[model samples]
Target: MAQNGSAPVWWKDAVIYQIYPRSFADSNGDGIGDLPGIISHMPYLERLGVDALWISPCFQSPQGDAGYDISDYRKIDPLFGTVADYEALIKEAHDHGLRIIADMVPNHTSDQHVWFKEALASEPGSAARERYLFRDGKGKDGCEPPNNWQSVFGGIAWTQEPERKDGKPRQWYLHLFDSCQPDLNWDNPEVRTEFESVLRFWLDRGVDGFRIDVAHGLIKEKGLPPYTERATMVGEDDDKTPSNAPMWDRDGVHEIYRAWHKLLASYPGDRMLVAEAWVKPLSRLARYVRPDEMQQTFNFDYLLCRWNAAKYREIITDSLEAMHEVGAITAWVMSNHDTVRHASRLGLKDAGARPQGIDAAHEQPDEALGLRRARAVIFMTLGLPGSATLYQGEELGLPDHTKLDRKYRQDPAFFRTDGKEIGRDGCRIPLPWKADGPSLGFNETGELWLPQPEQYKNYAVAVEEKDPDSPLALYRSLLAHRKAFSLGLGALEWAPERKDVVEFCNGPVRVILNCGDKEVTLPEGEILVASHAIEKPGFLPANAAVWMTEKAE
Candidate 1:
């Protein structure tokens, strides 16, 4: 077992890696990544130099939303592993000095959950139904949905239950996401008490902490008013906006987190929570990380910024300022299970456009350009003064499986919109471990839930690990230098920025990124690491970045 004397603020300066378990590795040759598979890869993570691992939801689920629609909070999904396997994984990870942050989905539950099942079977006014957002329909025959709100996936947000055999009109349930995922009513005291116990269940199991899913969507306004605008995955409303949307970033959500913060603080091992709230305006987003609330929240504004130097600088400044006000460190992320991988995203003609998914029919990305920019941005992101999140396979410079066939697509968004939206499956394909294998070494069997592209062979860990110039090598070197300099703990000091370039100093380390088309002369310093090789002395290549320390005397 690992020591529990870790600093309570360790996460502030830690580099936490997000692992999509199903796509990481497969131990049972079941064609799915599981806890055992993750256990086997513990050494690989240690080598990657991340302080913690934020494993996406592995709780018992019906796979309705790739595990987001959880059925049982206390049980591990059979597809992933048994509870014993999870315990083994936690032990193995701790032995490797890596903290485990489990994903906690609080916004909704799978319709198949025991609570939801009981809600469906019981009368409308019963305690069971009150646990979720069940309400009377609006028409004479009770055929209309409770509200005009649309689902994030598509169509109506409300799903009507089957007609009662007793001839009483059935009540409709609220599901902000897919119909299979019914949103729980946070206003219900029973629901709040149930989730608090769930948190304690995992905390007692020796896990480090949790990554809250949809952290902002737990509370809804009174009356469940109709939303006139189109429903989005992340709402635009902020604290300053008048008549804020009823579903997202409501003031009441903070109260829930305050109670959660108190619970986590009581546990040993410095257990913490990272919110996945996509609230607009850096100020509103900062509210989640207030002293008494969540310790950190994902900086979506920084992630969604255009790949321009000015835009990057602006977002970085705004983010740092906002987070500083709350006395909390910002959590920066470029890509994840939901968004397009930065390697491919930055290569698109319009890098600012956030397409749901890419296919052969869509505008193709400039592979080389994208990889170059991705590398540069990562260097700059790491140079910033806060924790960073590296998505799985990002160290290998993995690009989105843009050409994945629609037939193999599994994201609910695709089917919900009748293929109009390409869905997030392209970015969630199983990772390539070997350069050449039937399933690219993702599994012993040649089976894969979502197929890997042939080009992924070039980005395989086996291939990259052998090449010193590969992204994997760069990442390892960067992480080492980052730790050596204590960059994460250092404060940022911005230098007078040049056109198309971002320059800043973190203590003794001076970081320069050339975002322009032409190479820029490097400042006088001892070179520590560069994203791209410096062909000429004192010259930083375009779309490249380098870290340097002050020359001795």
Candidate 2:
């Protein structure tokens, strides 16, 4: 893509498909999916057509937070296979003309990571001890954690040490995510050096690039303030409450990233950096993507929109407008592992019907057509001005599927226990890969780590792949269309999608959708992509989406 060689090894214009290793597909029937499993599916990706695959974290970890909590940066977890497996996977992907960008979580590491464990064993002044953030507190004297910071998963963000050394009381370290995920002390040059080496480790292994997680949480203020919030008002009080003070997107994080980018600059291809900046304000968000640090930061305004056409239109337009001036590349996302699936969020049908085949005929508002409609939206979004992120199973239009009752959800949000909200696990369930196989194409060991719909097996890639009209097929077509036009640019123009449709244009191409409840007339022109069955040049169903590039007329 960057010719023979270029530097940010730019994936900015790339359409990245996320692969949650544990749930993607099982090659060994070991219940858990592994690198080999992902390798096996690379051809499928090439066929479906994508420039690159952004596999989710596969590094060594306890997996309490799936692969997000890394126990070892240089090694792949045995559960997901070994370093050799990863090398093979990457090499094979490249062989197939696809790029592979691994997920890198630099802000924190699992408490079980060797560095953190060593830090716990050493005395305060020891080299190992200086590698992490630690501050003495009254927790050893039966007092609560220092400066109440809430964990993103719930409860206090800092965890108190059970074991103490010398006469000092027990100390605590901050974790913006789960307690097991201890935040790294970026103030320490050793921490920066260590993470820098981690990047080189993969770069040496020939990785295309990295999608840095919680990219802005590398630093924290020297002394965080105590938590305080009014309890009188209720409903997700956690949002207003400070189980602990916020520890993300803090001060001094830019220098840390700039330093990392500097280290990455020496590599062969232009290494790419995409930051996940969840903090508010487009101004603050802009810092992560300045040419010095990351190439792009996640576009925040576009995803939170409600399903209404006008609302969606504004978010899209505003995002493009705001970022248009910034020197950084743009990125767009409709769904990710952390949020509700787009189909469900858009109020489309999941696996709600009985096992019979889905009907293309008129149906309830939540049926499969919603997925088809979603695919069309994805095509337009990915084909727009910046880079795009694809959550695993989004290509299949997979909906949320989780069975852990209220009490067992691993999400800290549930532990925060805000009026029975179904944490994010629903969006992280195993994928269905076969038409009638047990455990879908996912895990086989005990019932999968999360629940699977009965229609799960039927939704597998192996099955739907045969049907030319399947959601997977539409995704492939979109990807192919993208590959043909992504590198070069065309101006984007807003077009009519209908009362229910969401429409737009990129140069000479036009995209139309019938995201509403009735069939619509297609604009007269050359058609590029239609989410639903197209009997003629103009007729389209209620949920159909169409893409086109008209001839001179």
Local distance difference test scores for all models: 0.88, 0.69
Superposition TM-score, candidate 1 onto the true structure: 0.97
* Tens-digit lDDT string for candidate 2 (1-553): 2454543344657777778888787777767778888888787878877667888998998987888889989989888899999999989998998888889998789999999888888776678767777766654473467766666665666677766657556677777677888887777888877888888899899887788887766666666656453211112211232222345567588887787677767776667777876655566677777767877677745655545567667766766666665665568877777776777555534321111111123232453544655765775576576778788888888765533354445665555546234567767777886765467656454446666766556557887788887778778877777767652144568875457667777766676766566777777787777766687656777766777777657
List residue ranges in candidate 2 displaced over 4 A.
1-10, 125-127, 138-142, 165-168, 227-246, 348-369, 402-421, 443-447, 496-501, 514-522, 534-541, 551-553
Worst 10-residue stretch by lDDT in candidate 2? 351-360
Query: What tens-digit string does per-residue lDDT give for candidate 1 at 359-438?
Result: 88999899899999888888888888889999999998899999998889899989988988888998898999998879
Model 1 residue 128 lDDT? 97
Off by over 4 Å in 1: 1-8, 235-243
lDDT of 1 at 368: 91
Model 2 residue 352 lDDT?
16
Please give the lDDT score at residue 180 for candidate 1.
Answer: 96
Instruction: Name the best candidate (by TM-score).
Output: 1
